[model samples]
Target: MTDQTKIRSGGRAARRAARAAPLPDHMRPVRAGLTGGAYRPLTADGMDRIHAAVLDALEQIGLADAPPSGVAYLTGAGASLGTDGRLRFPRTLIEDTIARANRSITLMGRDPAHDMELSGARVHYGTAGAAVHLVEVDGRTYRECGVQDLHDAARIADTLDNIHFLQRPMVCRDISDNLEMDLNTIYACCSGTTKHVGVSFTDPSYVAQAAEMLHMIAGGEDKWRARPFISNSNCFVVPPMKFATESCLVMEECIRHGIPVLLLSAGMAGATAPSTVAGAIVQALAECLAGLVYVNAVQPGHPAIFGTWPFGLDLRSGAMTGGSGEQALLTAGCAQMHKYYDLPGGAAAGIADSKLPDMQAGWEQMCSNVTAGLSGLNMVYEAAGMHASLLGFCHESLILGDDLIGQALRCVRGIEVTEETLALDQMRAVCMGGPGHYLGTEQTLGRMETDHVYPRLGDRTSPKEWSELGKPDLLAKATARKAEILSRRSAAAFDPALDKALRERFVIHLPR
Candidate 1:
């Protein structure tokens, strides 16, 4: 076997052994199917309102005043690498071409998606950074993760998927140490992925410190100044939320440094912005556009990722419930808006407000993720278990989310039609011969790989066979699969000196 394949196999085996013990019933993932479709498109008037908002943003806000490189990245947002040797931007087509191109670029082992890459995909397992507060395993709960946990998590994630970036755990249950908590979490949790890291810091010095660490990790000043692993300058603008001055300053620094910024807006229908879905979308668009304008005005050519994550408030309880129709609408709307600017867009998926994995969580996560995928979003965040979302994380939920994302990716492949799919010759052969010999034909063999949906966890065997194999349910199968993946833990190659340097530079404090 190839060295890479061997490493992967061994790593999976190792992870599986670590999680060999059966999961408790409360921790097992809940099984639930898709809910009935209930989507409503915006009306003509609503569309007009949205159009006006976009126009206002373009004219009034304009681009931020940034360096040449920043301008090249920003104004060139949707520009594609053309065969003619020139950059091409489609004014008429507002799609996630930039993000798609970025994804393609990153997959080729480069930093193309910029900051979005860090926010988009990658795996980091274990308790570390901010995650220390959120992860409860082996009779441990709410314990702050130190530096050791962060490296361990990074190592675990590294052993799994090619973790491209890192996110600080939901450390600091209260808001007091939000910045320190987030930075420490990010520093500990991510390594050997991409150099990029993210945090929603509202303190200028803290943002600078984070930026400095990012610079250090990227090798030196030259690499740091070049990109410095795109850090986000995130802020909330709508009611129930207020914009922070530090975030604004960080956005300026990001623009000056050519770092990509994401203008995030989170609002709840009926409570924060509007009562209807369309109104909420419009408000979200307005908020994001305003941030875009500010960023562009400061540094016109700065790279940016447009984002919207608005949900509905349970009017009776005034709680922000993530698994709601509003969440799906917001996700879809963000993709649509990205098309308008020909820019990459961001939306949250795989989140449930439920404290545990349940029918509510499953349906909510599935609908939102499917909507984002169908809308052709450039990047979808929170693609794993985010319970009481913006509140906690569940390991089983993350596994289930991985499954859901796989399905969504399959959906995005759309329907393919080819000569083999037509199968005219095969049909004729079957008709002439009789009953059902076509299953053994070459055409069937050729088409099976493409036409069939082979689920990784779902039951497809006959009842007798299934019973004989231990009568495992979908959840049980998923659990087993997750264990299998964890068992094969092999390390990825990295510069030992650099890894050691980063660890030495950043120190984590653990309370005794």
Candidate 2:
């Protein structure tokens, strides 16, 4: 061969060798719990002003419709019952509650390895919703989600790397009884994934029974307490400054039973909450702080996630726009407020307004996911696979969302320009004497997988190569991945003995 041909062949060989296998989980370009907060939507003064308004809202208007027990708790903690029937929280009481609130807490997984430590600006993304419908990716249609769908959703999330935890996403429409539905929700999520699961209970009395089942799954109450894998996603307050009586009772039961509570205040802007973005945030904070006060009064420093999920509404039509830029701002602003209080916090993001996982969904999902990460959100829920404004969940979209979240996390990682990373010496070497390009360089090769994230479902080939590969279909690829993951998932989630016992005890809706 000619000398030129020999040199080209050697370069190609080195490039191939350098671009080796994908990095291990630890060495991947992006993973769960990466630091966010690169974006600051609210300045220090803006944050302070909003916080001051929040304090004023609680002290003045406060919240109505507190449960009798909740009233006692609030009154006992320096809150006053107004003649107008509003339970007004004193400034001192609210500040004291914030002081005593649990700033850091570990959200344990069924397997300890998946446990998430939430504090400061650490970020975690996971699935969460009450979507009642399924957006079939292949058929491009919708259907009511059943009990099995919820279980399958958890199973799908289990195999995904970027999806860090499982929150009961779908409502099991097949289950008729409320108690049975609650138990089945817990069972389905716990049985499908070992990741930390978030669940919601309908009534206060159901908690003990559910706790017993969780105890069984965790080997015993002691072990469960040691590493509680579940948390109560309680919508403790109704929007417009009112306490949800039943949910407040449930929250009380959750705190009493040693279950961590997520004090979720989901107020729709321009509808349930004030139309202005800042106003929405003020209301969310007021309600959640009331919950914090209640939890502290019941038991000092109880684990509670400050959940301030204020969704945007199309003021013209009064429709929920979970994917709107306003939604992203609201969530990011709430994250800053969480930072202001130094509490473990969570908010909703990554919901697609589109009915399907198409281009619209792409733009919508990425906008919030990226902003949430950059805003340093502690936990970003509904960050994948949700469609139809959270009315539908798709398996294929979820698989594809894993890729989307991977890219967003890489963005959150941003660019690290340290002494070693600056690459000044390497640049000089290449420019002065080495090859004119970096394609086959040692540093470039080493960073192939470490510095760059590769997508499994996304195409990265030239047009000629793509056509040669028969014009790959993104949806079809996601479908095949979903099937492979579900089929290859190892073992039934529980052993026969434990499985049979659980079945006999509760009306287990899911068949083996």
Candidate 3:
């Protein structure tokens, strides 16, 4: 069949599959938990006010001027190019991109059936588009994580259907000489996923290196340059709370390179911002819009993602309380504003204030992830292993996050209506005979799969059967499932030459 015919057939089959899939146990529309009693839909007036504010922000403040290359790397906050001799992200690229773009995109892979597309999910996580940190191996910790860890992480993400992008592994030991290390790190990590790679265009030279590395991986410069890859430069505009000149320069570089930008505005409500959730959201939106306008001025259609991670402050210790209800509300409100602009929105989900894997962590993470999902965020970041106000990453948290994301996706599947579901013919046949019996009908056997999901984790056994297996909590079952996945996990193999080439790119020596 021709490609067009194949697409049509595939679309039909997908619809049928969607209808056939059993509805999730929790099928009601998820409500965003605001500080008030419950979430109230945005009124027409509220939407208009937000729109006017965004437009005004775009026209008034306007983006800072920077070189085309610098504009290409624009990020959020007050980030600008050329700061202390280090490159920075431009705020303008981010502002402009948010003003335009389709905002919606399906994160599909080899199998469309496995795709999970959101209206827009918030994307943040990287301050400079990628994190630089040390890694723990066995009992000892390593100072630097070259490209090897990056590739490993990429391979793992590639195997999972839920994770969409490859983020640079936390590798912060030496930044001065090993600039290429970060670039290669992002490339290796992103090579495994079909989705985009988030990177920091803080260093223009490194940005060029990353672009070259991507070209090499895609089988030459032409294909690599043509492929769709997502990269955002971040600026911290709002200091204990915004972006500076550094952010503007990075954004400029991103604009020059035609890379997507994210205006990440993160401030602690009640500290950096007002205590009220609505007030915090407004401030965060203002910060993001400032960046958005800059990007639009440089290039109207530059791809951008709206990112708001405004949290509340722990008044006692003056720390950012990422688990506050205000954070969830900010996510939802930002999503509304982004939808108005038809721009992709991003926010934090699965983040916790807890120091470890405990009840607090579970609840906080669940609430945040659910809020983002319900708010129609296109790119929700921090999907796996964030802790202590997003200062640490844990393997167990990553495993738990996979389950959480699975549940969220199931929630978004919505409901379906079909002949098989209603069982009209079976009802008629049985009713005609005075409700005697339809259990033995062929129709029942043929449609059983269409009516049930048969969850792999939830309990459905009878009391007697449950007694035989020993009663266990859902957490225990989830733990067991994680063990099973780890046991069956196999590392992805790559072309030996390609792997060698990728590794060679990270040739900086570390202090022993």
TM-scores vs. true structure, each candidate: 0.70, 0.96, 0.70
Q: What is the lDDT ranking, best to worst? A: 2, 3, 1
For candidate 2, lDDT tens digit of each residue in 157-212?
Answer: 88888999989889999998999999999989988999999999989999999999
Native-structure RMSD, model 3: 9.1
Each candidate's lDDT (Cα)? 0.52, 0.91, 0.55
Query: What are the per-residue Cα lDDT tens digits for candidate 1 across 375-460?
Result: 66655666555666556655555556555655665555455578866778778878987666776455664444434444555567
Model 3 bad stretches (over 4 Å): 1-41, 53-152, 168-178, 191-194, 239-243, 418-493, 508-512
- Candidate 2, which segments miss by more than 4 Å at Cα? 1-26, 490-492
Candidate 2 or 1, higher lDDT: 2
Say which candidate scores most in TM-score.
2
Q: How much does each candidate deviate from the true structure in C-alpha RMSD? A: 11.2, 2.7, 9.1
Best-matching candidate per lDDT: 2
Clashes of each: 35, 1, 80
